[model samples]
Target: MARLRTLFTALTLSSLTHAYIAPISTPSTHIANNDDDDNSDTPLPLIIWHGLGDNYAADGLASVASLAETVNPGTLTYIIRLDDTASGDRSATFFGNITLQIEQVCEELAAHPILSTAPAVDALGFSQGGQLLRGYIERCNFPPVRSLVTFGSQHNGISEFQSCSATDWLCKGAQGILRSNTWSSFVQSRLVPAQYFRDPTQMEAYLEHSNFLADINNERVLKNQTYKKNLEKLERFVMYTFEDDTTVIPKETGWFSEVNGTEVTLLRDRAIYKEDWLGLRTLDEKGALKFEVTGGGHMTLDGELLAKVFSENYGVYGRPFDGQKETDYPREKEL
Candidate 1:
């Protein structure tokens, strides 16, 4: 368990180290919206949300944007940024409130000329960014989302807070607050990670104190029908989990499974799905909800896997993202 938690922390903290060291040799110079007359030939605009400890300026993110451009030409790739500068954006990922961050993103996305004018946009979320986009979709989907794809996201919330380095005061400070008083309103509102800390042993506390996940999941007493209604509007929803993901404790969370000791409750069997609180049941029935897996530790993605994802779920003209996309993969089942 200790080793697993350490690995999870690495995914958050050390992943940044990798990004910082390996620089973008030739950064993408193209503007987000380069199309002269957007038409059926052009693919739907793709917006990406970077994970924890990461910003839009990272080389990996640039590579992803470049790859999407290559795989599907005339693709407009937008990487969401909370702050103007890369350093500030990275800092915001650790300490600032996520609810406010999502709100800022909502406004920016809505005000953009290209995104606002377009019919709909597809989303690609990494780690924490995945859930943030979900929150955005559920709370305020101004333009609506055509397709949603997430990699290594904590959709069901995380059991453990990330460990931080000694020198990094911001991450260490957030860790202290999370570990010290996770259920406190102060921590829940201030610390970004605290909002999604769902403990199996503390069900009542989590439902009572969890501001983001519980509200979005409709786990609270008074359910918001709009969240469910808005989510059901998606053309396709895909979630990918790492095959050997030690970084995310209880990896089944990506599939919306509840983990308790040796027992695992798959999403289909859970009341969350059966009840269709978030409208996942609607998606599943229509053959839109896809569950996929990739080989790696945590966010270890290769070109081939990325190409496959982009090709199937995104690009090239009309229709709601080529529903089902691939026939080789079977329907989602217990892991």
Candidate 2:
């Protein structure tokens, strides 16, 4: 009986050892390979600029980064955080000078090691961030950007409030406040005023001073070839907006509209046919400019939609664990 008990004890110990060793070996192999792969594979880097009054660590920015990662596991997203204090005591970021913001972006790109490499990096900008990026690319010209994707951006300045309804009391009140000569003059006095909401007629005077949209659009400095060349370098210039985007009214501004007419659903009608003031028509002619109109509202985008856009325009695709060749994901019609 003692001999039998000893044999059973030895078998129990052997079983325990095997169980422990088996699990350990699998994880160890996986960890080593994962570490090696992470070190060897350089991820495709992308810079993200958040909307007004948002920070680099904002939840929306995180969601965008996660969505990008889902589509391409190799994406490395960097969010550019601006100085929130620049707007004075109000701490309003939109009120902050866009030229200074562009400078910050340039500084960040110039400093990043991976972003400074040969193949140009991509960028995703939202709202005011989008306009800021446009300004940056047109002016800075260093640190090449391969593609730019903007959401609800006011590229040509938002003029929706200019046409406020006479019947709608709320709209009238808001427009009255913004259009007041005193208020407009006060905004003009500010370091970097919100150019989008400014009246087109008064834009010339603001442009002469410190208006960001005016300077970047080359409204006064049209003779600068470098600005045009810099804009032409972008491989893809994609803009997104919805039919009911009230914030960026006259949504054509998002695509750099040459003429302001009735709203159109199709991309062809919305696009600028002639070489307008913004020079984006050249990009359109090269097939680099793309406009995506969705049924959703402002700042609305999901992983599926983002994946489709990236795959169609940027050649980004999914990578399955089975080690198969990555293919372009089919575009969804519902977006």
Most accurate candidate by lDDT: 1
Please, what is the TM-score per model? 0.84, 0.68
lDDT scores for all predictions? 0.76, 0.55
lDDT of 1 at 189: 76
- The digit string of per-residue lDDT tens for model 2 on 164-225 reads 44565544554454455312444444323345454455656556654566567666755566
Mark the regions of model 1 whose C-alpha exceeds 4 Å error after superposition. Answer: 1-40, 163-177, 320-335
TM-score of 2: 0.68
RMSD of each: 6.1, 19.3
Candidate 2 — worst ten consecutive residues by lDDT sum?
17-26
Write the residue-wise lDDT of candidate 1 on 104-140 in tens digits. Answer: 9999999999988888898999887888999999999
